[model samples]
Target: MNTGRVVLITGTSSGIGLAAAVQAAQAGYTVVATMRDTTRSDALLKAAAEAGVTVDVRRLDVTDPESVAACVTAVADSYGRLDALVNNAGRANTFATIETCDLATYREVIEVNFLGVVAVTRAGLPHLRAAGGRIVTVGSTRGLIGQPFNEGYSAAKFAVEGFMESLAPTAAGMGVRVVMVEPGPVFETAFGANSGLTRESLLTEAGPYRRVLEPYLDWVARGAHPGAQTGREIAEHIVTALTDPEPPFRVLTSDWAREYTAIKYTDPEGGRVRAMTASWLAREED
Candidate 1:
């Protein structure tokens, strides 16, 4: 029962992207799983095998315009149509306050997280419009509520959320659906491992900010948030966002994530979220 639908996914080498590729393939979509380097695709291949499905692997570095265009072209040529696109390629930044974070780190995060989606979406638009397809981007809860040490990553996701919102109406008119899947903490993922980032590396000079940074770091060490979701759980929501006839414009990965983001709407002035974060930073040891 092949759906005859083709979906091109970015960053499929591991974690949520890999899980979505396998799930989409098992659900009968012709899955084009792409990563910056195909050399890291063993995990994806193995996952697909375990799921008793096959996915076409390709090289797609979202940060590179040439690579993005080539990958989209190759998927269109090889598959004849692209029915869906999952914009999931991203990089986590070193935990640092804006004052301490390097400009280069911010640039790198924005290039990959925000501009990468722009590039890939630009290339895939014609094909998607032709197929009346869906565009699902993997965003983060931090996009709605800023966190202590996630300034750069959150900024990129905030841009993504805004970009998608601006594009959705026009795309709907052109018969393309746009969606964003926002996830909270994900477990058993290597996203931050290779980012060449650590909290310690970010604090070269403790200065006066150490007081604020110390508690957040201590909280994180004691489990930042309990009951974090796994990559597979987030991927499931992404699959649903793609396949549902009337898919939601925003899909938060968990109940907690949804509740957390809802605070923004409850208080548009940013008072509630600000207060909550301040409370977290001010909490004393138990």
Candidate 2:
């Protein structure tokens, strides 16, 4: 039981964030579950109730520096200590090739998915260092192997990978443990729905890229992929990363995710990844 250890999590209105919050609280940590809008916290509250745990729900907009600072300050002031930080707040980009995606969309994706993590981490680091705490960021397989039509999202996640990987050692020097929990496709999350995209709409909007988009979407729509996991499953990994005394720098949520990302490490010339992801866009007959 973590007891009085206070852990702050961002984007807890739903999905991995909410699950992690409840699970962390269940595991006996003082969980501060935060989201941009507190009004959307009903689901999280319900989940916590069902889990026989309670969480401190708060409002935190990671994209806004003031919100980030204020939330962290309030947590510190209220608890007098912070034990961990879970960077789970992020948005999925609408499906579009780089050439087809507007610059504004690209910036928005980067801002929320990448810079938001940065802002929250920067604000929480001091408190975390004081308690010898942990920083667990929810990473994606798209970060390891870039997807065809998800240019903005993949780029942002890839940036997160680099940032966390580089900061892990430095944070460790300050008695802070940083870990990245990499999940492949996650089910029961707002990720897909939040994109506000459907197969028909994407197909119609794909323009010249429809041929490629069709196969990719088909691959995605083939029910659950081998590496796919539920948000609860991914949250379990996050909680482990938070509580494990000697957690690894990277936590792959599933065996499939481990095997999938392993390709990048072994492929020196990037040929294997290029060929594999390209296959996702190839018609079945091809």
**Candidate with best TM-score:** 2
**What is the C-alpha lDDT profile of model 1 across 75-113, one tens digit per residue?**
999889999999999997567777876799789989999
lDDT of 1 at 107: 95
Please, what are the lDDT tens digits per residue for candidate 2 over residues 1-286?
Answer: 6588999999998899999999999989999999999999999999999988899999999889999999999999999999999999998777998777789989999999999999999999999999999899998999988988989999999999999999999999999999999999898999778778898998898889999999998888886387778999999999899889999998988999989989999998999999998998999898
C-alpha lDDT of candidate 2 relative to the true structure: 0.92
- Please name the candidate that would achieve the greatest lDDT relative to the true structure: 2
lDDT of candidate 2 at residue 120, scale 0 to 100: 94
Query: How many pairs in model 1 have backbone atoms within 3 A of each other, for residues 3 or more apart or on separate chains, i.e. clashes?
Result: 0
Clashes of each: 0, 0
